[model samples]
Target: MEPIDDLVGRLGRWSAGRGPLFLLLATRLRQLIDDGVLPPGALLPPDRRLAGALAVGRTTVVAAYDTLRQEGRVVRRQGSGTRVAPAVPTPGPRVAETSNPLFLHLLDAPDDVILLSCAAPLGPPPELTRAYATMTLPADDLGYHPAGLGALRTAIAGRYRSQGVATVPEQILVTTGAQQALSLLTRLLVAPGDGVLLEAPTYPGALDLFREASAGLLPVAVGPDGLDVDAALRLMERHRPVLAYVVSCYQNPTGAVLPPLKGRRLVERAAALGVPLVDDEVLADLTLPGGDGPAPSPLAAYEGGSGEGGVIGVGSLSKVVWGGLRVGWIRGPQPLIARLARLKAVHDLGSDVPAQLAAVRLLAGFAPVQAARTRALRTGHDHLRAELGRLLPSWTCPPAAGGQTLWVRLPYGDGVSFAQVALRHGVAVLPGRTMDALGGSGPYLRLHFLLGPEALTEAVRRLARAWEEYEPQPAAPHAVAPGAVPAIVV
Candidate 1:
């Protein structure tokens, strides 16, 4: 049995984040269990004893324990009391082994290493700073806004409406980021053993989340144009997935934009099949110079205003404005939005109020911000491509129309092993396997062009060195055809 004093000590600063007290307690307890600090089958302190030690009400402790029990993390009986659940084999990668290298760097990284693993702006734009400067908060209202501030929600809805999606404020539910929006939707729609349709080389974060839910992943190939709608529909009809997630515009890793005709066909088919489609448009606004005119209307635009069939659109400012700003939203039917808001409230009560206020201002004057971002991105993208072509001419690096990454196919070896070599050579890159659901992208690597020209050049030099050191391995049998993965022209 874990000692009450030691357990309390392990849960240091647990109450720092917002949300219900029980949720905070449960979150801390979950961490301890996952870390094996509280070993499997270890008995926990009685609710009253823990409550007394943590200086909280017994009910809070009880609710926390109940939450854990619901997650199957603990087993409780009247006579035997609560004990940590015995370890069991689970689907997908362990929580400790995050697929995104950015997370690993966040925890710890060497100072000299050039990070090409995560594709994000180097710094917040001037517009973000200006937005923060002029932002004001409400004095009379309590800060909590589970569904987000009304003004911000209105702004988000208006943005969607302007893009041809007939959205109202009632359809918007603001979340911490697109990541949380996905998490909340997964909780609501996906159950253990349920099937989820995903693009083959999708966002690593989404793959991680679905895997954590123990959802069976169905991988559909995505090319330069976008998701293989025919393959996706065939799988939907055969497997009847509970949910389908797609990055409709400027997809992560691949940087593929779904053609408008295909987008319409996909939503229409998904509606007919009764599968809730989640359109992740976090990268939609990241259009580079000399690329496609503008990202096509969001997937929701294809689904009529009836809102009966699910075509949930998720958007975020993390990619366009800044990652630290942490403002994102979900556009769905009114009922779905309302339910998601309740789920979000249980997680964080609400997103940062000041951030929401600033987001409103940012959206109001977004033209210049977007223009500036695309210009910088275009420069970075061109510079990175040139360096790669000159330094490692053998590798097949396709040009992306938009988005931060370039999906490069290795000349011979797999990405997983080469990634380790790249890290040792002072550059970090994401292995294609981590982003792939079926491990068919072994011959590929997703490299970001977010760094400055000098840094990108240095990173490419490091990668070239790593390539020389890395021994060539025979291509994996499951590797997809290089011809199928083309660059996004528009």
Candidate 2:
């Protein structure tokens, strides 16, 4: 049992946020539970006693206790009062693999629900259409190049060279998409119970993959300028992680671009630690109109020389061009690439030949495609931000210069529970808890701005209605000053 004064001291400034009194208290209690400050079987103060201590109405403490009870974090008995619940055992790999909201949305896409859960381009760009039109096949070829087609490999290596990372065709391996690239690397590097370091509040797909592999996830904080290199290095020395994954350019949910200096330090430290680092750059090319020129060169570029044996770069056409094209590649050392190719052969023999041919042409003429993408993304991003501000002003939505999604912080209630209310109102937004390995992003949501202006307006309107219904209105609403809420850098 925790002492009431001690618990009160631990929950410093719990009422600083703009949420309902109950929700703010509940959020603070939830954090304590998650941080193990209030361990399982620890007794909580009585509702009346806590209300007296905090100087709030007894109803507020009751509601807060009820919230934690509903989440299975606490147990309340008729005579004994409330206590923290025992930790549940981790689910099996099969069950954990498909537990993400992204997969759930895909499996059961209800009609009429505006899906802001998945963040992929709507369709192929005009350049992709033209590439398919000009795609050619050789009559003499069997097309079983498991390491990717020769022309496509060459094109990818050439592209790397242009970006200041020296590369050769042998260092590139084509996969179905960036997801497959991540899967292959996880299979090659991580064993059951091995530590795999990554960013907190990262891409949900990657979290699903790591959980499926049964790897112990070591999460480092990511900020506006990108990953915390010093903290990552400390974790590496402490945990000796087998593999480290980072979305260096235009990070998935947060849209943070890693500075070159941090990228250099990270790869250098990882290399010294003999940790295989996978730099996921799928969203790198989707730089918006107001972004700082282009995204910094791939993390591999910072390693100098051939960039072999240190950082592995993964890129895809899915984000910059179209998801249907299904073209992605991995750039690594020749030996690693060769080993991955053999592993890939057992899966699908090789990627689709026609798609690779088209990718080659697309890469040859990518400047125009990039220009078109950035223009559309800029419009969508601005429109979504404007609509969110106009309709749901209390939600803190930081401006993302690039990438498809916005990481939003709700003013009051947690995202997981509120998302259900949002869904009932005909919209599906991803809760930030799904993206977090430690389940700490309770008040955040990942909302993609891929929809056009009209659709975005509708989505925000539905979300506003959902918020109004879900949150209890106080007699006098508190006004949050502009920038009062800190941005949640994933």
Candidate 3:
């Protein structure tokens, strides 16, 4: 988008509420061109001239034009102004292999589109952003740092301490992202064919990683109460998996929090069986409440100094500040962290020094990022829960005490197909199978309320529309209307 004179004035005159003017122009204009308002071979106004007409930044005009060209909404010949395209190619899912397009597709979607796909914080707090921008020098300000700085290690450990888990900085190895941390741990701890116990609807990509390691994946049941503790224990004892990865707080698919009681029980049981607990507290910012009551600290806390080992807690700043800020770390026994650090060096030398600096700034400036996350996600969450309760009474959402999304079990629908339908309806939804280690969601969908009215509601409504289409029976006769019960065929 280029600078244009009176850009603000034009937008004020023509634009409506809460949308990027440039984006709106691009969208509406593309629709116009498609409808033949601007016939093929018709010239578009020059960027600067158009900016004057719309009273928007010339950059906005340039962007609108660029998008038009990119999407084949228009064509430009050398020495000629842009011309309407004969046809426009509708945008479709871009499945990129080299880089994860799942993340990128998110960026491409409309800002108002609900983002249930990624477990991301709604947005960083102002204090956090300020702190990140004001990070100090000398710790290699612009240098590359693979292992997070000693300061961050101390701060992260301090964070866990308040939650009653005392850990040493040396016991924490910071990586680029929590996903990266998990990847490194898998490489270091899991050997091909090693048994790995995971929650059935566990983190989806993790299954892929464990598979790549050739680990024999085992699924343990997790119900509305969270992880089926006894079931998990049995699986752990039976398989003696090389890694027993579980999300302790605000679990991904279920938004299940492992309360303190269950956390202790799980740790003790795992220790008794000699199974490592790779606890991912990635979304454990105490940001969302759980249906089962208060959230628990890391399961590793239950380990204490029992010297049993095998309890490692993984987390990162991506959820708190920005996903672009690729800084994740693991806290466990010092020896294990050191080993993980060694493992981290293999893929990439280190995290960006600037990012580490920003993280440090974030930690110091804000009392705790968790505090800010809680405040930010609350309103959106309440609205989402309320709307769902009213519109989809059959859907089960077990009141997440804290997390970014609600794990919803559709009473009579398959999550996978619903998600596919959501895409066609212009909403983004992640089904249970994709998130599960086992390929079944049992009619579940993860609804992210963090995006708020900006996107969440529309997406949910779109999902509701999809649901409406899925109902098998047509409208019943007057006897079967709202107040009356129909005859039961069975």
Candidate 4:
């Protein structure tokens, strides 16, 4: 299984829309083995690891392995892991090779393949390296700060104060990243089966965490103007969700910044309904310079009268600094922060001390890093928009006001199928379905403009080739018979 684990993620694109997920995965594995792409006796990755990579439920991987065993295509030993059966019979008829984008991205591409999935900046700002050189941790002290280092906490609190929201060091709890902050909040605020509201196409990572908590979802649609204040109010009143999560600043997938008025109203309405709101600000400072002027104050700042609002804020250095820094903080009422810190301690004890020191240094000297990142993002945004217009004229790609991606709509064909074709052209793009909470992300795909101008040009060129070569999926048998009429199922 040395290299097989690396190959398991490639199965995702091919597994899309093809019967039962387990069967599709199993059949694809069989095809690879029969074609000698996976030679006889090749070891398979552990089911759990493969499941994590695919972003599928582990049970899917378990069932797939079971199906392969039943077909006599793979063998599972008591002590060792699964392996392809030796001298496998040839597959019947020549099944067409999978056109999955991930398959090609993983197995076919060379070192220079373009990336459109990740929105992370390439590296930390130069100031970070210098900051690390001058910063130091206490040599004699044991390094455990569950609520984060005092200096870092003070620095982060100062950021909130600068934004008009008065915060103290005690109100901030640092976690490994914004993801961990979400996890901690989910566990603290949501009970199993509790109703949770979110935007229709919010951050997929947040959706995954809520799903993992078994929270019932109430999705409100978001348009180009960001979360609809009216729709959010309606959903809040109707569903009575226990908690609602929103990305008010430079929202993900859509790259739509919430209008200040709408953001204020949404927070007020949620507070009126007694539902707590979590505002993810990981992409807050990434506002494209000169476009929106400046990012509006966080939703929590809208709390008027009596000082207590339902809003809780989460911030991270990952998007503004480098993702590798692994520094993020949760800002909420002191009581919530205390409870969350207890839960966070149980989860991982504490985040890295050195990274926290680095973050503190970066925050102290953030002006230059912010300028550099803004320049990079603005360049990427312009290049991507220009290329899409030149190469994909029929496709509608809205210009991003801020944030790292352009949410594009295809004039024809499904994003899933188009993604498979794109993979073959040496470009990898995420289909829209991955971002949908209610599985309504049809006809859309998200493309990150984080790459440089040259790579963006080449990537779009590859995408155009893929678009030309893409064939519409053949109609499935379930659609209709020759003269049969459709009937509604009750």
Query: Candidate 1: which pairs clash?
Result: none
Q: Candidate 4 residues 2-21, lDDT tens each?
A: 35433652232445443777
Candidate 3 TM-score over all chains jointly: 0.71
Worst 10 residues of 2 by lDDT: 481-490
| Counted clashes in each candidate structure | 0, 0, 19, 0
Model 2 agreement with the true structure over 1-490: per-residue lDDT tens digits: 5568757765655776566889878877886565444656779999999999999999999999999999999999999889998766575544423344445567677778998887888989888888778767889999898999999999999999999999999999999998899989988887766778898768877776776565666777777787878878987987698889999987877788888888888888899999989999898888888766878898888888767868999999998888888889999999999999999999999999999999999898899898888888889989999999999999999988788889999986677778778989999888775665544566788998888899999999999999999889332222221111111111
Which stretches of candidate 4 lie above 4 Å from their native place?
1-112, 305-308, 471-490
Give me the runs in candidate 3 sitting further than 4 Å from their true place: 1-104, 107-113, 139-144, 287-294, 306-308, 473-490
Deviation in Å, model 2, residue 258 alpha carbon: 1.8
Note each model's CA RMSD in angstroms.
15.1, 7.8, 20.5, 13.7
lDDT of 3 by residue, 112-170 (tens): 45556766665556765676566566843545445677788888877777777767777
lDDT of 4: 0.75
Per-residue error for 486 in candidate 4, Å, reads 31
Error of 3 at 100 (Å): 9.8
TM-score of each: 0.78, 0.79, 0.71, 0.75
lDDT of each: 0.81, 0.81, 0.66, 0.75
